[model samples]
Target: MEEVSLGTGNWDRLTGPVREMFVAHARTWLDEQSDPSWALLDLDRLSACTMPVLLSRGSTSPSWFSMVLERLAAALPRAQRKLFEGLGPIPHVTHPQQYTAVLTEFTRPAEAGEPAPGR
Candidate 1:
């Protein structure tokens, strides 16, 4: 549990403003009722958002933002969604340990300042 909490905090810190974007995009998703599957995220915006700061040239396109947004639209509780954002994404987790490891990494035990137990 400590590991999860600390990991989440670390992810949040690393991602910067990504949480806000995820919330905004998610809220935008919730109020609108539509077929979730076909909902294509704005890939262009996502590309820009994931782009590194130094390499950045123009504003991130909505498509680029959609990459993460699309992953989040499971109607999951906001807390869970925020949790998901902190961890980013995993390409593959074949077993329980792997999955748990990913989730455990992001969520801190207490608040941001407190330290978590070592992994």
Candidate 2:
């Protein structure tokens, strides 16, 4: 799964719907967060693309995808925050603790994860 986010500049408004998903990963990512401005830069770095499918049995669930989903869930408002919980841990790539670790990192982890403000 690919992820995207827009910032304080109406990226969400600019988004359009493609097939299967919205055209604006940036908008979707940002709106999911409490502070859209912080995630603004992610918009530039992220884009729609064909990602390689990892074939490891451990890759079945896909750690990379889980990472994106977790962050998306945490970015959303509390009422809508259940998105993160729904992704479920990646079969072999992520541990239960990783769910929190990944989500918190997406918002603002001390180290090892993308912090808010897109740094």
Candidate 3:
């Protein structure tokens, strides 16, 4: 199987255990790509979703991933986009505190009976 690591940013920053886990799961990750259903993006169905959507990505992620996010953000009615700077594809695993902060900030307004930012 091909070597698998985070798509961008500092892979070295990932803990050894985390890196090992990723390495061990590389085959499964690659196998997922072979499923045709994984490639589908039904924008019409997505546009019909009325719930709040938080679309996040690492600033250092591959450009194609950014493009996909941009497309989804445009299509989704209530999408709020966030960029986590200096991180890679799996920011939540690499920087849990930062990820939690972003998620909390996104949900705070809703929890307070206020409209989320994009709404």
| CA deviation > 4 Å runs, candidate 3 | 1-9, 32-38, 110-112, 115-119
TM-score of every candidate relative to the true structure: 0.22, 0.19, 0.75
lDDT of each: 0.36, 0.36, 0.75
Model 3, 1-119: lDDT tens digits are: 11233554456667889778877987887787677776568889899988788888876676656877887998899898889877666678778899899988887766658886656
Clashes per candidate, residues 3 or more apart or on different chains: 24, 5, 0
lDDT (Cα, tens digit) per residue for candidate 1, span 43-66 = 445444421121111112233334
Whose lDDT is greatest here? 3
lDDT of 2 by residue, 10-113 (tens): 22333244322545364664566556454343522233322211211122333544465455444433212223332322322224454455445445634655
User: RMSD to native for every prediction?
Assistant: 17.0, 16.6, 3.8
Supply candidate 3's per-residue lDDT for 14.
78
**TM-score for candidate 1:** 0.22
Query: What residue pairs are clashing in model 2?
Result: 5-26, 6-26, 32-75, 32-76, 33-75
lDDT for residue 106 in candidate 3, whole number 0-100 = 81
Whole-model alpha-carbon lDDT for candidate 1: 0.36
